[model samples]
Target: MALFSGNQKNTAQNVYTNMRTYLAQKDGAVHVVLINSFSQLANQVFKCDEKYTTEIDYVLNCMQREGYEILDIKFNSIPNQGMTGNRTGFNTLITYR
Candidate 1:
């Protein structure tokens, strides 16, 4: 993946930026998913993946309870051995609505 030169921080920034724009500019339900692709920082001390996933869940659930629709749910898994570590060759897709 030579084409990739970014880190979790960059990915997070991009996600928030895009999401903010999407929510502000559009008036509809938003489908979100966080694949195992960013397993790079999955094991960090703060467990950022878990935190983000939790936030997504809270928001989605709240929205759903309020009569909004959530097409997808964020995941909560530790597919990576370590945050700064690297691994590949495995594809995990867990779906929920």
Candidate 2:
């Protein structure tokens, strides 16, 4: 089964350690799929920093390393929902097909 680590801060060393644990255990036996979006990355307006970018890339890279396919979607505008869709959240979908 796929698992999501609750959003938390991890030191550089801890990130690496957790990744190693996940990879060593998954080993291609299960279809590991990490679903995330460019929108998610762009949403960190307040926590904007080098560390944020690095951590985002780290998770993405780890997902890639685990043979998970990454699909990026782009949206032109927000839908009728009363929410800030400026980050492209309105244009993404994740499907196994």
Candidate 3:
């Protein structure tokens, strides 16, 4: 189970800023589950069935640019639908030095 706290916008900046705070509480590799539960980070911030892939991807990219290494990513792919049929993509782990 993952926990996300924030009512901020769905912008990468907002998400990234919040992520920094979340990461600050951790020491070493961190386990984060960016699934449907964190949909506010997506472009469709309301009345949409889109996953947080884009938003999460944005954060992931931010992490990479900051010299963070991706330890693992465990997500399910449903054909040509990334977040349409079954919204489930909770498979990513990040490690930073």
Candidate 4:
């Protein structure tokens, strides 16, 4: 809805920080699900519905920067044509080794 506002970035950073904390709490390697609600909002804002894809790319970069090994990322199937109610939602599953 709003152009990359400070609060938005902060929220993402906060989630990442929490993720880091969660990872630190674990004794061994971990598997995580990273949901990019920002990209979801972007889809709704721009009416493009491609936010999931873009967010996955961003997540890939983040993982690379953080040096986390990726197992897989779940993605939303494009809303079926002529139907909004049937929209399939998704989440990413990432594994760190």
Candidate 5:
């Protein structure tokens, strides 16, 4: 499992590189949880500049090229207590033979 909180420091290239490294060490199902975008409150709370965001499709395509099959994609959200509100994200299930 991989979780990316959409840190402003993380670029799409960084994510892809990390995924490649992870895939190299495994040969089964992979679960990826990524913060698609952050809310205004989340941005302030997390001190994120929103300078970089990962393109879900782009990441998936890179994975597919590495021989992984896309199994499922799901949208998810988490409710926060006060100011941050709900955090929206996505889950991707993939498998490699």
Candidate 6:
């Protein structure tokens, strides 16, 4: 699971780089499960930096640029916990040749 928090741009770049290297050595599909919490309360609770959150479009574009086909994209709303409310989550399935 890829938890998108902190410095999102840097995190995405790092993840892309790692994935590129790994895919070069393997021959199979890659499924990336990305979870992003946009709730400020949740961010504070989880100690996630709120300055920037992962943008789904950016991530998708990055992978597509590397020739990875997006097989499926799914979204599930995370139920609000006691103190934290309004958090959203996304589940993506990516396949690479």
Instruction: Please report, in order, the local distance difference test score of every candidate based on alpha carbons.
Output: 0.41, 0.41, 0.50, 0.52, 0.50, 0.52
Who is ahead in TM-score, 1 or 5? 5
> Taking the tens digit of each residue's C-alpha lDDT, what string does model 3 give over 1-97?
1133222225656758766765643356555534333333343335543335455667778777876666766654333224453333343444443
The local lDDT score (0 to 100) that residue 60 gets in candidate 6 is: 69
Worst lDDT 10-window in candidate 2 = 88-97
Off by over 4 Å in 5: 1-10, 24-54, 79-97
* Candidate 5 weakest ten by summed lDDT: 1-10
Q: Which predicted model would earn the best TM-score?
A: 4
Better of 1 and 5 by lDDT: 5
| lDDT by residue for model 4 (2-92), tens | 4544455556555665666655333456666656342444244446545444445555566567766666655544343223444445555
Candidate 6 C-alpha lDDT tens digits along 1-97: 2354545667666766655654442346555544343433444365543423354555668767866667777665455543445554434444444
The residue-level lDDT of candidate 6 at 35 comes to 38
- Residue pairs in candidate 5 whose N, alpha carbon or C atoms collide under 3 angstroms: none
**Which residue ranges in model 3 land beyond 4 Å of their true spot?**
1-10, 24-51, 75-97
Residue 74, candidate 3: alpha-carbon lDDT: 62
- Candidate 5 lDDT by residue in tens digits, 1-95: 12453542356557677767556434574555443433333443655323323455566677778676766665544445334454543343444
Kindly report which residue pairs in candidate 6 clash with one another: none
- Residue ranges of candidate 6 with Cα displaced over 4 Å: 1-32, 39-54, 81-83, 91-97
Better of 3 and 5 by TM-score: 5
User: Least lDDT summed over 10 consecutive residues: which range in candidate 6?
Assistant: 35-44
TM-score of the candidate numbered 5?
A: 0.45
Error of 5 at 22 (Å): 1.9
Q: Which residue pairs in candidate 3 collide?
A: 74-91
